[model samples]
Target chain A: MTTLPTPGAVRLGLVIDLDICVGCHACAVNCKEWNTGGNAGPLSDYQPYEAQPDGVWFNRVHSYEVGDGPAGQTVHFPRSCLHCDNAECVTVCPTGASLKRAEDGIVLINEDVCIGCKLCSWACPYGAREFDEDVGVMRKCTLCVDRIYDEARPEAERVPACVSTCPASARHFGDLGDPASDVSRMVADREGMALMPELGYRPTNRYLPPRAKGSGCSAHAKSPALEPVMPEGTGFLGWLDRLLSA
Target chain B: MHPALSVILFTVASGIGYGMLMLLALFLPLAAGPADRLFGAVSLGLALACIGGGLLSSTAHLGRPERAWRAFTQWRSSWLSREGVLAVLSLVAIALLTLAWPILAAPVECIEMTAAIAGLLSAATVAATAMIYRSLKPIARWHNRWTVPCYLTIALASGGLWLDWAGAATGVDFLPRAVAPILVLLAAVVKALYWRHTDGLKSATTIGTATGLGALGQVRPLDPPHTAANYIMKEMGFRIARKHAAKLRRIAGGLGVLAPLLLVIAGGMVPALDRSAVLLAAPVATIGVLVERWLFFAEAQHVAMLYYKADAV
Candidate 1:
């Protein structure tokens, strides 16, 4: 009764470029805006203008300083559902609610069947699945399946909200199965890395490493060097320094 | 590991239950003549009660109790599935043994040997049950090979004691009181070995390793990502005191090992109170093991502990 994973019409996935990302969080904002209005709506913010704030976000950006000394700098990494090839989340669900699509390789959740046991959430190490307390079901990134396949939407704008609103064009979406696809070419040209490869989750999303910076491309180059100068007011320490130097 | 009470009760209660059944199955065949239907009936009844109690307790842990039957569908991949299957097999064997006792009474050689074989099968079921928890790779403490033997020891020790009491109450000397001493020694050694093994095991991942950087320098969290505790922290980052932990370990050692050993030794010296010593040691050992199992869940460190800033990832 066991069957191998069948080849689908489209293998939907994402490619995130670390080089051009500015960490402005516009993608996160747009994602919240679109998803809140669309199928997975109302991200449930605890309080908008309160002392303490907490809410569910589809995309979260992390800023880290890597390298050392002159070459050390900040890199912004955005994280979301990887939609792994060997998804433990799907298999761990006891209610048969979590499932992968045969047509496009996109993983989805059936809210009606979900018992909210949170086993699927625990199985996933990426912290992708979110529990909706109001509905008593698990929620996750659907890869915007409803919008992409909509015939009414324009061809150019037929992509995820995060990808469409990326101001720096750092996010790319396509089928990676074909070698000639833009995502495949990008991955081939620039060495793309999967997060937590050792875990063997086999995430669908791939991250392209930042391009190396050229000579004289440092951010802190404009700062002036310290120079010795005479003090306006004379102090005991100043007098001591003068006496010692002489 | 979250200390889901249902699972704890299931493992402990069922362990005692199935283990007692194994003891009954072992002794039934040894009668000088045909098996006593009355004695056989009592043994089978106690075994069913224990298994039934365990199954009932485990179901309470599920969020949706109605959907509990769905868990048995994934037997190919889950240890929980195998445990269920083995429990059923043990139940069926007990039923068969009970029914045949009245018809097959009398013959010392045949009865004793069949009972011994049944006892071994029951023990195998206990081991399989323990292996369910031991198989998880993410939890370093439970995944070790020692989990199965430790569980088996607890079951044998507890079940043997209960059998002694039942036999005494019914005015039948079915099994030896000497089983208490063996159980005590075995339980003591198993606990010691488990402690020794876990002490040498390394942390699953370091903070540096979690970040995908090979840096050797000390890394501390400058700021936690969120103010409220997430699900991961609540489940995996439970911290217990080192001093209290050491103290509890001593208590578990005394109850699980030392007390039972003393009682058995006393029974051996004063032959009059042999039954009493075994009966006393069994409850003491169960209480001790319950405490031990609680600590096992509480003290276990998960790889996700790296995210909570408890240590170097």
Candidate 2:
């Protein structure tokens, strides 16, 4: 039951663009919001209103400074379940509850069948799986299965909540299994890379690396930095600003 | 990585159980007379009790203990499932062997054959348990070449100690006194070698490689996704100080290895202390193995922790 589907089966996953991701938690927040009341409802929050606020989040956006000082790039990396072609999380489920869909290759946990041994969580190298203490089951990104296939929802709205809500248009979702698919073409054009490919999870998701300096046609002609309001100490505030900038 | 009591107990206790079961099966053929049935009852009772207790404790940590039955279905793909299936099969074989404890009057061939099969099954069950950890690629400490050997040797040493103790008390040769010491030495050596090999070994995964951004430069987390510790952090991010781990290893070695070895050697030297020393060795070695089990989990660095600000896994 944990065996992956046919190799060419539609692999539904995300393509996150690192170039434009603004370190916004919108996707993660939207994911939690929709999923809290969606297929996996009431995503447990241990201490939402207290000094320590923790909850189950399907997506988590991490910001990293690659390099040091001014030369460094602030890359916003969003991590979640990749629904890999060779998902150890699915295979490691002792009760056969974690499985990759044969049709679309979306990995899912059959909560009813899950014994909640948490071995699946241990098996997952990505740290994608989260144990729901409230329900006594593991939870992860469902890819909005309920919304994606719902005929009642609009075509555009049928996408995953994270993809739908990304303000910077950094997230894209489609079937990567199809060579002719838009997602696949995007991968080719951008030279999108897989995270930790050496681990051999065969993660379905791709990440478009930040475009090289002076490579992609940028909106701004020069680096975005604040210039002194007045030339060379026309005001005390201006002088201070120039001094700080130096 | 969390070092949950349930898992530690399950491995240590069941290892002892399976080890004892296998030894008893092997020893049955060496029996001379009516003493066989009494030995069978006592050894089987102890082995079964340990196995049953350990199995039940494993379920204590499960989120849904009621659905644990379904775990047997995925033996084809899951090591955990295979462990479940094999543990049950081993129990059946041991039960049958115990119920139909070989009669001295009965033909020798059939009894020995069944005993061998039960012994093999018990060994296989222990292997499956080790594999549950060994197969995990993310936890480098568990997935290595040392894990299986460590488990097997530890089981044999612990179980052998018990058998030797039982045999001494009952004046039966369940396992040769010489054999238990050899196993104890082997276990001690293997454990020392494993520790030596793993000491200061850096994980292949690092923050830079994890994000696939090592080409750019060193990748350091500017901001974590959450301020509070999440489930992943709490589970996989367990940190044990070097000093703390070193002290525990010494404790485990002293109790599990040195104590048994010394007790056996001393008992051999002083025949007067032989019976009492063997009796004390079993419980003491079990506690040592328990401490060793705790250190096993505490020291393991899961690859998933790399993404959560761990410089390396």
Cα TM-score per model: 0.77, 0.92
- Candidate 1 ranges with C-alpha deviation above 4 Å: A1-11, A18-79, A92-95, A110-119, A130-139, A155-171, A210-246, B31-46, B85-131, B213-220, B241-243, B271-276, B310-313
> Which residues of candidate 2, in runs, are more than 4 Å off?
A214-246, B33-35, B102-110, B200-202, B241-243
* lDDT of prediction 2: 0.85
lDDT of candidate 1 at residue A211, scale 0 to 100? 77
* Prediction 1 TM-score vs. true: 0.77
Question: Model 2 — TM-score against the truth?
Answer: 0.92
Cα lDDT tens digits, model 2, A1-246, are 876567656888899999989988999999999999987787999879999898788898888888764457889999999888999998888888999998898889898898889998998888899998888899999999988999998898889999999999999999998879989999999988887787788999999988865432344546687875657655788789778989
Q: Residues A1-246, candidate 1, lDDT per residue (tens digit)? A: 011156465678889998888877888788878887888776666565676665666776655555666565566667678777767677656556777777777778776566666666656666677666555567788888777888899998888889999999999988876778899889889877765666666777788777777653454576576665756337898788778877
Q: Residue B223 deviation, candidate 1, in Å? A: 3.9
Compared with the true structure, all predictions reach lDDT values of 0.69, 0.85
* lDDT of each residue in B189-304, candidate 2, tens digit only: 99998898887576667776678777778888889899989999988988853349989999999999999989998989999998889999989999999999999998887888
